[model samples]
Target: MQTKSAARNIFFGGTIFFFVIFVGLVAHSYSYIVTTSTNVKTLTEAVAHGKKIWEENACIDCHTILGEGAYYAPELGNVCKRLGGKDAVMGMIEARQENEEDTRQMPNFNIKGKDLEDLAEFLCWTSTIKTQNWPPNEAG
Candidate 1:
């Protein structure tokens, strides 16, 4: 009788222990979800348009932004900050259209005006993602 009672106690205690662990893990996951969801920036129509442009142009085939896409070109995850601001990004795009010898030889997409603005906005939005300093440094 004594041995049976000890075994029963042990089984119940182990079950409770595991249940508590599972609850803690769930709570932690929920907290992370809440925090990250709140931190995410709201996507606008222009940003969506710019995202479409990025996809249509296959920009990911060359550049890696926020650790997604290809690696042939420089990481543009922080290009806005690196280049100064949105205007700088537009200027670079315009310059790429004019300059024949850009480092990567980006094709002159002739993307201009609002398209340029939208694309820059999209890139800026990507920069704001809370990736925890991904790519390690700006040189990526």
Candidate 2:
């Protein structure tokens, strides 16, 4: 063990051991994410459509959901709670009116009909996900 080659061997062995551990952890995380993180029951047509709308409208560009996305706007993870349940969530989203006053702000997405309902439903569903406590702040 006192030899230089012995020391080098130990170093390489430790590196390989840590690398294996890291790889194992990554594999476990991937499996867990695939199997447990999402609740498939909550993933309905409405949630899918709502997710599509979110992507199409680039809502993540301004808002964070479940603490993921740009920080420019408030987090929509627990928005159903923040805004007060489904009706309130729907109200806030529906309240956006197009203003021609020349101001830099959240634009009117003009979400209407089923699309509006679906989007709100998606947010409500998101609030119910098992985050183990995230955003950790009143103002996300």
Candidate 3:
């Protein structure tokens, strides 16, 4: 262990061992994602589009989803259930589209029609996920 050669061998061996472990962990995580997480059947093209729309709009900046994101706005993980349904969700978004009110500074994104509907669908999809009873409140 005192010799330079022995020290180098130990360093290289540990590096390789850790690298293998990292690769194995990555593989295991990928397998779990493919086999256990995400209901792929529910991920229709519309849902993907809705997710894209959500990202583009940066809704997470304002609202929380599944206990993630900023705390500025209300948690939206179960918004569909709390608000009533997708239609109600749509109503809220549509109402915000051309909003001219001088209320809390939620800027108008002008989202309407199919785009709004698709966003609602994405929100509804999130509502149905198994969150182990998160948001803790039925009003979320």
Candidate 4:
């Protein structure tokens, strides 16, 4: 009688443990799906246009953004903030165009007005993404 009772208790306890784990996993998955779907709709038209420019220019070929590209140049994930602001970033780009020195050659794309604004907005948006403090330091 004692042995039978011990076996029944062990089986029931194991079943309950597995059931709880399965339920938790399902709940976590549902929450993740909902959150991701909501965030996906938050992307604006400017961001979409900036994405196209980034792609067309092959910016990732040299610079890494959020650690997803080549490492030849500085990571531009938080460049907007690092440069002080969106306008400052545009100024820096414009300056690079005017200077054109061999020491650091960032070719002037001649991006102007709305294009610059959209690009800057997209970069600012990228900087706000949660990356757990990627690039590890301001130097990136």
Q: In terms of TM-score, how similar is model 3 to the real structure?
A: 0.77
Model 2, 1-140: lDDT tens per residue?
29999999999999999999999999999888767777788799998998898889999998988877988878999898788888887887866545646644778888888998899889988887778777687665
Sort every candidate by TM-score, greatest first.
3, 2, 1, 4
The candidate that wins on TM-score is 3
Residue 36 in model 3: shift from native, Å? 2.3
How much lDDT does each candidate structure score? 0.82, 0.84, 0.84, 0.78
lDDT of 4 by residue, 4-56 (tens): 88999989999999999999999997887667422455579988787777787
11-50 per-residue lDDT for model 1 (tens digits) = 9999999999999999998888667733344678888999
Q: Cα miss at 67, model 3 (Å)?
A: 3.6
Q: Tell me how many residue pairs clash in candidate 1.
A: 0
Better of 1 and 2 by lDDT: 2
Which 10-residue span in candidate 3 carries the lowest summed lDDT? 96-105
Please write out the lDDT profile of model 3 over residues 1-140, one tens digit for every residue.
Answer: 29999899999999999999999999998887666655667877777888889999999999888888988888888999998999999998776565557646666888888888899999988887766678788756
Give me the overall lDDT of model 4: 0.78
lDDT (0-100) at residue 2 of candidate 1?
Answer: 70
Span of 10 residues, lowest total lDDT, candidate 2: 95-104
